[model samples]
Target: MPTMTAAQRRDLAKQEFDAFLADCPSRLVLDRISDKWVTLVIASLADGPLRFSELSRQLAGVSQKMLTQTLRTLERDGLVTRTVTASVPVRVDYALTDLGVSLQDTVRHLKTWAESHVPQVREAQEAYDRRAGQEVGA
Candidate 1:
């Protein structure tokens, strides 16, 4: 077998997932967590578990279909867990797994950043729109 050069050895030792690479597995995770519903759902569970109805109410504009899909995706990804209790109608609750809890700080920061940057984003959008309008009228 050919011996690896020191540089080659170092590169192999330092290999890590890079989302910018088209085939990196981390991109799948990035895609999943970056969804608006995923972010909101994770943020909503920061307090504790919530029932489907409760989550729907808390999430404002999310449709029942969208919320169900979001919850299912999160659960499948091991970031959340679903619990069921027998009742007049079976009750289901969704809660974060430890993996999900670990993500809370990042989720919180993202939510905060978006909330804080609304004015800047709006200004940028309005400016771009005005420029586009002028270009079209010119």
Candidate 2:
């Protein structure tokens, strides 16, 4: 009823941000994207479409079940296309969609950041571990 104060406005903004985070599918999306198999499958499609067997070959150490689940998630996100060709063997190919192509820049940036910061993060972890050990010893 009364005019809101600056602190109230800031609180409102923070609340909105928290609500947005809760509403966003970030956890589900990250659960799918952060997976090693999913990243490999998406990267494989970067060049062009590939049949299921081709994808399996390109991505080493991926189980067929894992690959299937990853592809389904990507397709549901509108990031990948799956086509079944009518043939004697009934081949299927997976390719990145236009939306998925737009994600390349983001993925590349993440890769760059990880490469640049991994050593720093490792150093911090080791320092913490050493301090923790000293406290335990004392």
TM-score of 1: 0.90
The parts of candidate 1 lying over 4 Å away from their true place are: 1-10, 13-16
lDDT of 1: 0.96
What is the per-residue lDDT of model 1 for residues 1-65, given as tens digits with 9 covering 90 to 100? 89999999887655557676677788899999999999999999999999999999999999999
Report, for every candidate in turn, its global Cα lDDT versus the true structure: 0.96, 0.83
The predictions' CA RMSDs to the true structure, in order, are: 1.8, 4.7
Q: What is the TM-score of each candidate against the true structure?
A: 0.90, 0.68
Off by over 4 Å in 2: 1-20, 112-128
lDDT of 2 by residue, 26-78 (tens): 65676667776766777778789999989989888888998888899899999
